[model samples]
Target: MLKPQMSPTRELISLDGLWAFDIERDSRPQAWTGTLDSGLEAAVPASYNDLFVDSAIRDHVGWAWYQRKVCVPRRWTSDRIFLRVDAATHEGRVYVNDSFVGQHIGGYTPFEMDITDLVAPGEEFRLTIGVNNELTNITIPPGSITVAQDGRRQQKYLHDFYNYAGLSRSVWLYSAPQQRVEDITVVTDIEGTTGVVTYDVQASAPSTVRVRALDASGTQVAEAEGAAGTLRIEAANLWKPGAAYLYNLVAEIVDNGEVIDSYTQTFGVRTVEVRGAEFLINGEPFYFTGFGKHEDSPVRGKGHDDAYLVHDFQLLEWVGANSFRTSHYPYAEEVMDFADRHGIVVIDETAAVGLNLAVQGGLAGGATTPTFSPETFNDDTQAAHAQAIRELIARDKNHPSVVMWCIANEPSSNEEGAREYFAPLVELTRTLDPTRPVTYAVVMFATFKNDRIADLFDVMCLNRYYGWYVATGDLATAETYLKGELQGWVDKFGKPIMMAEYGADTLPGLHSVWDMPWTEEYQADYLDMNHRVFDSIPSFVGEQVWNFADFQTSNGIHRVDGNRKGVFTRDRKPKSAAHALRTRWRGLENQKPGTSN
Candidate 1:
């Protein structure tokens, strides 16, 4: 008999109406002061490709402007108003009433600006956002590049996915009272069988805060009291995977005799660590049987609704997947929260993908042009990475499901002068949260030296597509070659190994072993051989397929859309390989120790 979880009282203000857009040419400063007359129309949460019928406007890159008017209610004046953007690509400058408010550089993380001081109650205010995605002369990762098409080098970006740039996620206006909860961090020490909850509380005025922890049966287990700063709760009912005993935290901010602000969060107590290559959760060895998922759907690139999120998790659960990786980028916070409630382990990743190919030039065809050149790793890139990392961690740190902090995905270890760049970034992750292990997925290059950065990580993961990408037609030979590589790493580093990524691209409509690269049967066979290889390696800790769904990729070769490496179609239809992998994972989980199935 568990008490029902309290829903967060947050309102989403839809910013999906008509917006005016135009391209900017010169680098010189220009004011958006004149009467709004661009006339170009676009909708929110819709990409530029969705707006224009012309291929030029749909594909061309430059500066664009989005303008709209928003009104605030008179009664909402007593609370703090925040203008939040789910995501904006490249760089953007936000303005209110033609006055510059703030600027953000990242393309994937959420950012907010306090507009309480600038907004007037019950009045329509003009909000203008200037977005610039021009090809920079800098050498940082993810810049436009010229590639050889039909033996002629043509200009293209050195990224792995389609650049469907815009205000991609969501935009909203919300009001919170002046005195409220700023941040909350929950840490579990399951080895010691104890729980520590820390709340970084902020308030506009002085107030006393009382915190209480209640078990699933509504029994008060632990309590604490503090002023307007960090509050900690100790020795509480801990949370585990199968025995997921969660607790509810209720915070009461009282000034006089009245409750000023109240905040409640459901949290679980658990500890996750990497022992060599094996991951231990709550002092018991656990294997990650999971899939790599992108935040995209067939009809909507990233426009998935709440029901879709829940549906995706249900599918994973059905397949006996105990873990998930938010491939290449940070997912919506709600998704992580749901993972916590459902007892699934999560690898919370940053939006720092595609930076690898841009920074290192040799892997994708020995091209010398670097996207994120080491020369241009300046304050702007650093600031953007820092902000993205901070927001991602701060938003999802409290969830018990998140076990590892992935700094970047598939970055090159053979970069020119930045061979040790990943090491420092791994250190940065530890600085932020020393409790969880830090790791990154690296491409399986024979000459690639991971020792430079491998020591910084608690687990070593390899994104190998040996049979599919390297061997192509001979999966049996590819299996042998991949096993050699895995054994070599295990003997050398003695760390736990995870097949971070492995899958074959296949077309949804086709199914045959003869379909070299685009057949569902071929995909299923590739996974079968790889899983068999994994069975022989006892040091191998886990396996997550290359992807969970087919997604948009501007860099694909066979398909103009993207790679079809998913176990499911973009529309969430199950593939034959998905069912096979499900059976394999279930068998492994049910197998007895010391007996090979």
Candidate 2:
């Protein structure tokens, strides 16, 4: 799960431009060996669904093909060559010169295959990657596919976000030595003014290992000569919210005093814990003030773009926020690296967004049924969920910016068998990485009275749409109900509560003096009401609104274009609710410690 980087011993080439693409139809053979027959091209590092104007292509189910030709570098003959796909939607299979190589199931994580023996240096080979967008009951983010009367396959899921699919991230061809650093795990702590970083390295083979801890100025602060050891820094600069400082931990493989491979991992010296009703970072009470975000844009559709990435963080800074959640899925690795450099807190989440049958029924217009039955989200689904947690932690455990792990979002905690389904998963997450808190976004239906798995989590991340979905424009009743429910959680669980998602959908230009729904004025008023309740509860630790910006969703009458609960519009334009948040958060920023909001 180590991110590919270029060093003196390693080289990287980005396969991130136009590639030949086609869709499978009527049991067509895969374009594995020769050039694709469609003669159509699609951009890499982007979803193919939004790139075309054809409705059939936009809504196509099943698999799509992307093929390109790559020349192996001449110098890479002596090194091990790898073909790395950052992500391939739900499932991806790779073929090199018509020979099947490797495949991976997870859509949001990385997968790689060693191709040194398959091709020679200074030679060209056809690289074909097939991505399947279909999700079934066994997938991590479960969905059901049915054949319509017209004989076309249709995909339906419980999640509200659009199921954008394809090669939504970068693909790379890289080289490394036969004996090199495989993985690096760093756990950081602070004892008084000194920062302690304990690291463990996994190598391809047995070799003498050298580790060095260097500061921002490239001065070596500490060094060790083992595969696993600790580095201590005197007067260490701690990485805090809104103030980031990083140390580079370099690992080198030495064979007879000659360096064969080198890799550097950037990490921050920080610690996170949930003690009683307070969420602490670096042993200080910390508040989360941000939004639940998605890797979505106009045409890219979850593609990782540098321009959008920088701009989104800039917007988060402009809004006077300190934290955000990767709402319903694990985002690109580049996003986590940026957060680490910028000192923004993250609640890392898995792609377990659609596990609730009741929520799916309400949104997708289906009959409510037991969600955890054998035919639905059963043992296979739990196995996939366990793998999702494993990959997520393995990829993100070293990040200081990620303080908590959100295992699922708005699952059916009120349904039968909820406890049986979620208990082992929560235990697995804690076993993977014991440093971070564990939580799941609770739907309004899963309340203190009926929620079976609330006690399994360390924090209560409640996603309640009281005014928008329940009360429907009645703020007075919404406020009362919200306060009562929050009080119930505090009384029952005695844990820190966070309003992980709460907002009203509002059109940009819509206006109403009476504060009607879908108006900018009502969105602002709804936020104020939620904040009043948050300030009154000592156990309420944070507030991240429903969304950072409007995003695309499956077509339905409940959505106009997409979900409009974002404080900012789809294009990063701030709505009136954004101004309200700034006014409150900025004041909190200037408020003295121990003072009330």
TM-score of 2: 0.98
| Model 1 lDDT tens row, 458-552 | 88778888777688868878888888888877887778788889998877778664747667888888888888888788777788898888888
Candidate 1, which ten residues in sequence have the lowest lDDT sum?
A: 1-10
Predicted candidate 2 versus true structure: per-residue lDDT over 50-146, tens digit per residue: 9998788889998899999999998887899999999999999999988989889989989999988898999999999999998998998989999
Model 2 ranges with Cα > 4 A deviation: 29-31, 360-367, 592-597
Candidate 1: C-alpha lDDT = 0.68
Cα lDDT over the full model 2: 0.90
Per-model TM against the reference: 0.86, 0.98
Return the number of clashes found in candidate 2.
0
lDDT of every model, 2 decimals:
0.68, 0.90
